[model samples]
Target: MRSSVLALLFFACASQAGVIIGGTRFVFAENKKSISVTLKNRSAQTWLISSKISSGSAWPGNDGAVRPVIPFSATPPLFALHGNSENIIRLVGSGAELAQDRETLFMLSIAAIPSGKAPPGSVQMAVRSNLKLFYRPADLPGDPARAYQALGWQRTARGLTVENNTPYFVTLFKLSINGEAIDNPGVVAPFSKRQTPWCQASSRCQLSWQSLNDYGRVMPAVVTSVYTTSQGVSSRVITSASPSR
Candidate 1:
């Protein structure tokens, strides 16, 4: 008797399987009603593509709870992407009243499932690409390119606290504390603060971090020193020189 078991695999990045997304991240300006994202399939097999917009609160989890509907929608949410063909997916907004002074964040998920049948006793893989979608208002007060340098750092009793006073979300990566790498240095939300337990309270150490721009490119590293004093805690920038790309 033939075995009836079928295996399924999930991938976070679809580029390895021949599907190329046009951009790493997407920004939806408030002045515009919608935006278009291009997807190209380089594989020889046709695939079923489906897209969705969500708050991304329940991702990487198997909870069966139903999620609330978001204000955005993706047109032609489900379609067949033929091999070596390109298609455009339009993301339209419903003019929901988000934070006018700060940018709101969402998630766009694109899943590609193989249309062809898998070989007997083989596994069928499905690739899911999750991209950050930011809704930026028309008139933000500060420059997004230089917002990373304006982050406020303080040495707290628990650890190091990074504050974001700007209207744009700042994502930090390649973070290091005194030449020691910090794992999973996360993003600081717009007008919010995040604390990480990477540095001690009463010690002086060098901290380095790099931020991601709107196009998802990593900018140059910003090195600074975090020192504590009798009055309180403070940070001083040591270097912010951009290296040759």
Candidate 2:
């Protein structure tokens, strides 16, 4: 078994910032879908009752003023500009379509906020504007008719197993480690019956990769691709690893 050696840093670490700014989707097509901003109150205190994103993009009226949208709706939200730090306020919204192609640009904004009875200084402000891309359904097609398991890990060697949960042809089977492309060790047009992941070796240690299940269309392979200086190695895809029996 692998052991951990580094210091454990939980979410509650004292030095962690009280507020954080982020979004669900970073990339999307224009006029596609709205995005959602995640506001995390890492501080022990509850968010101020009056809190709402104070600063955000001014929506464009026919005249050209930025209108702000709060309690942003939808996921993968967009913002006007790129800002930094939890202390910086961020807003999201749709911008007037580009004069060139009529495509809208996502906008974000940031500003300082009043803490109210919490601290002498104003707290950080966070908000969302809108999604540049309108919206789109998940690309992964509804759940596969059949289910397959994928196994992956950080460091260490392991065996693989394949279970034909459904019927389909899994094509162009390949393997990779630490981002370096490698040829499949065992030569075979069709993966063996088990379809389990196989791997060993390391930039500094041996790793493993294997195909677990063939359900419908997804390649659905698992890889163990994480390592630690202290623990030696740990597999991220432990569940993908089949039982020793």
Per-model TM-score on C-alpha atoms: 0.84, 0.24
Q: For residues 41-154, write the lDDT of model 2, one tens digit per residue.
A: 555543321123321122211113233233233322222221222222323334423222221222333222323352323223333223122111233332221222322223
TM-score quality measure for candidate 2: 0.24
Model 2, C-alpha of 129: deviation from truth (Å):
12
- Looking at candidate 1, the ten consecutive residues that score lowest on lDDT are 59-68
Q: Relative to the unseen true structure, what is the C-alpha lDDT of residue 203 in candidate 2, on a scale of 0 to 100?
A: 36
lDDT of 1 at 83: 91
Please give the distance, in angstroms, between residue 235's alpha carbon in candidate 1 and its true position after superposition: 4.0
RMSD of each: 4.8, 16.7
Q: What are the per-residue Cα lDDT tens digits for candidate 1 across 104-151?
A: 677899988888777667666778888878888998998887787788
